[model samples]
Target: MTSQIELKSGTAMAPADPVLRDFRNFLFLVWKHLNLPEPTDVQYDLAAYLQKGPKRSVIEAFRGVGKSWVTSAFVCWLLLNNPQLNIMVVSAAKDRADAFSTFTKRLIAEMPILEHLKPGKGQRDSNIAFDVGPAGASQSPSVKSVGITGQLTGSRADVIIADDVESLNNAMTSTMRDLLSERIKEFDAVLKPGGRVIYLGTPQTEMSIYNRLPERGYEIRIWPARIPADPDKYQGRLAPFVMRMIQDGKGPGTPVDPKRFHDLDLLEREASYGRSGFALQFMLDTSLSDQDRYPLKFRDLMVTSLDPRMAPVKLMWASDPDKRLDIPMVGLQGDAYHRPMWMAPEMAEYTGCVMAIDPSGRGKDETAYAIVKHLNGWLYVVASGGFKDGYGEATLKGLALLAKQHGANKIIVEANFGDGMFTQLLKPVVSRIHAVEIEEVKHNQQKERRICDTLEPVMNQHRLVFDQAVIEHDHKGTSEPIRQLMYQMSRITRDRGSLAKDDRLDVLAMAVGYWAESMARDTDKAHEEHLESLRDKAYEDFIELVHRNTNSGYEIDEPSWLN
Candidate 1:
């Protein structure tokens, strides 16, 4: 005669197995039934902890490592085995939450010994609490699963597991970021006091919740898989973590070769994704591999001033393949310590200059034109605008006006893309405007590669100065351009030419190319202008020095010196 002994979720644990009697023993027993091996160092640590420690009682592992399976089993064992303990599981996304719930349901069904514990509800359904315990236990524990983003305001949890708190693939997008921030904030508020949280995810950004978990006082666990102790070994740590995890469930088997744990052959076969898959999945360092994100570090281009008072400079305009205008063209005019200063209205009287324009015709984007002069320092950025009707005619007209107004000596424009239209459509309408003579040429390099190859020396030598006005135009201008430049600078050369994210960076590279061409030209105009300004300022500074010298009784070798 089989007696019906209902478990919390209403499945009957007929014949009352003793191993399924308690949470800890149930976890161990079910692992055996599922044919999983025993736990490893991490697994043992997790299974033992409901208390604070240096190692996160709550932990995160990288993707594709079966984190969900282990965690789900852990939660179930806690609830079904203990009559007094309730467990709550949360995931960053709906899919992940659903997955956790599904895993728990599957574990219940697969082990007939624990099959009586199954909650009669569907798998992946959230907010369902199952009364899981032996009948007449005085109290029964409840296990509930829910999305982290759901309405968690008034809810309570005993043990919360948050999985994949931020979206990895779409972290950089603005819309995605807003959603993630809300999720993090809500998760922080939900867990009950003394209730523990186990957060899991790959580190996608420095600002991501997984990375910021330490700030909230959650202990951290970092596992970098693909990075070999040495460059040659090439084996990853994923295999080791998995082996340990599986071992914890069953019992330790033959010790795994750390190298053979992660399938090198499977990864190697897919060559293009080798670095990313290994770095993100195995190592769990998101910032190191996320190429599309902005680089927080600053790269110094030029150390010189833009003011003629400091140093005069020639200016050139470079247009890239996209013919984007309004892109910044930077120049250095003074030493590193001094920095370029814009010519004040008073100082503009003595400056003469040439102008360059990067023209874009009939596009939604703006047209960029610069009037540059050599004063005490280099001062460019004459004027910028969107083309009327998005046509080149307006740009050419503006260029003519800028040249005449600024007394420009020469105009340089790339005739590669419909630039000849300027001469035909614009020259006839405007006087004193001609297409600058330069032949268009194509190169074999990709945009990212070209920028890396050419801009490295310029950046290292401090020869390029990004315009402050342009770089800080807005968040869009600042974050996007800087993000691309860093990707180019950190070129993944050995990996056959792949850098993280680099679209807008090509515009910045065009600006660099313009500066290189301009600096190479005859500096006679800029040099002469610089000297004149120097002479004018030298007299006043010399007089001040002389007055101080005389008053302080420091010997002044006036006519005594050069005189």
Candidate 2:
């Protein structure tokens, strides 16, 4: 077939044969044949990266960038250049992979320049697997499609195109994300020597698998819909071409591809997908987005050393320059623990102490506990930890000893699991160790919402405080960061199961909720009530002195001046 393209304007032009060798030229010819508009600047840049990028690379572009279409055309260019090379397309689902292959096959069949590479007789011709006409006999087809979880043992490929393999459904929980990570490892075994693997997708969460691929020696390049104001968030991961544009004075909110997504269009999309969603999907930013989505802030809680028996009568919270703690923080960006700015000189005994337990059986879950003390109008977290031993004797006795050591007046156990069996088992242990009152509490509302509702307000008011030792203990006690209390507090959202393991945060929420009524009392009103009680006691003592004198043998006499 001649490398000539006929334009819609009823004219024919034949370019040099070497022009077709460039993937960008090939893409232009394909677009003309499909009667689509001319390729945008960003699309041309994408084509350039596909041709000259590293062997193992990732392409993270915003939605509606037409990345898949450009890639499909590039696949045709690859076969036109070398028909013997085998390629594989993988996705989270089988149908998506098939669609990619189908589009590539259609391009080869319909385009005149690619007519020589069309599948011939006695060759695999289906969409799932197909071979080019000029390819020699081989064990693998010229192009094949499969899901990430499908059979990938015996196949081999020179190029692997992973198209949106990390979807929201497959990467919701830690276990599911782990399984997906393991499953994708099959690509290494299926890859031939000196092969290339390309990943194309947006991140689903802050812990996205795409973010971890860089540690394995894969070079990543990201292109957002607009130039980012905070380029530091990308950590120099932005495409060199994009960085150049930014250096050339392209301000933030300026559309990277004005032909496709203009300012008005992007604004509409931003409104459609809230700020967080737009940040994740369009901007490819996870950290700043999560800071907006998650309600709890680590800096809101006052961190200080506290005596279990007594606490300051009044404390003030501030986020001024000197109030920020220098401790390690795992919360979102710009979030850090803060110490109180001021504290009263007077100290008083705690009103009550309560222990809350989030019970769990065996397996990956843990039975978490927290001890909280209530004062005038504030709550203090003193102790918290998790027991992986489940309902075993060690776990029960450990919990009993913790309550006894903390001088807890009541123990509240979450009865969601095992139908109150954990509470019953704990009763015998507590009877022997501390003899504290145990109460079973059942919850019908969603766990994430409940925890956030119970904690966000108190944290916002700076009424919740954490002992410095508790923060240190929580950080060092667990090998898995997800099980840590501070981790749970900083990462939870209102969405159900937003946290993989929330037992630690759940118990903390329950303990804080125990003093909800007391927290409702205004600080000034409580002080006034205390003073009124002191005055009533003084009046009663004066009356008692006069009555005692009247009952005595000697009668009470008036002052000499009065006589």
In order, candidate lDDTs are: 0.47, 0.87
For 1-563, candidate 1 gives per-residue lDDT tens digits of 01222334333454345534433444455555666664444444444442323333335454443556667777666555543455656665666676676677667656665555654433222334454434233222255666666766565566767766566544544345546656666754655666667776766544455555555676665443333333222123233454454445523222222333444543552364575555556545444453433221233432232343233343332323232323333211111222333322233442445444444557433344444443323334332222334445556666566566555555544344474654455454335554343223334566545756655555444344444443334223433332333323333232222334343344344434555655443444555665577666876787889999889988766543233
Error of 1 at 412 (Å): 16
Which candidate leads in lDDT?
Answer: 2
User: What's each prediction's TM-score?
Assistant: 0.51, 0.85
Query: Which candidate number has the best TM-score?
Result: 2
Tens-place lDDT per residue, model 2, 1-563, is: 12453334432223235666678888888888888888899999999999999999999999999999999998888888888899999999999999999999998888767777878999999999999999999889999999988987677999999999999888776657778899888999989999999999998766688988988889889999999989888978898888999999999989998999999999999999988888888899887656656889987899999997899877889888688888767786678898999987767788899999998878658999999998889899999999989999999999999999989999999998889999999999999999989998988999889999999999999999899999998888877888899988887888776777788999999999989999997866665565566556766775676689878865655435323
Regions of candidate 2 where Cα sits further than 4 Å from its true position: 1-21, 173-175, 267-280, 285-289, 320-322, 326-328, 362-364, 523-563
lDDT for 288 (candidate 2): 66
Model 2 poorest ten-residue lDDT run? 7-16
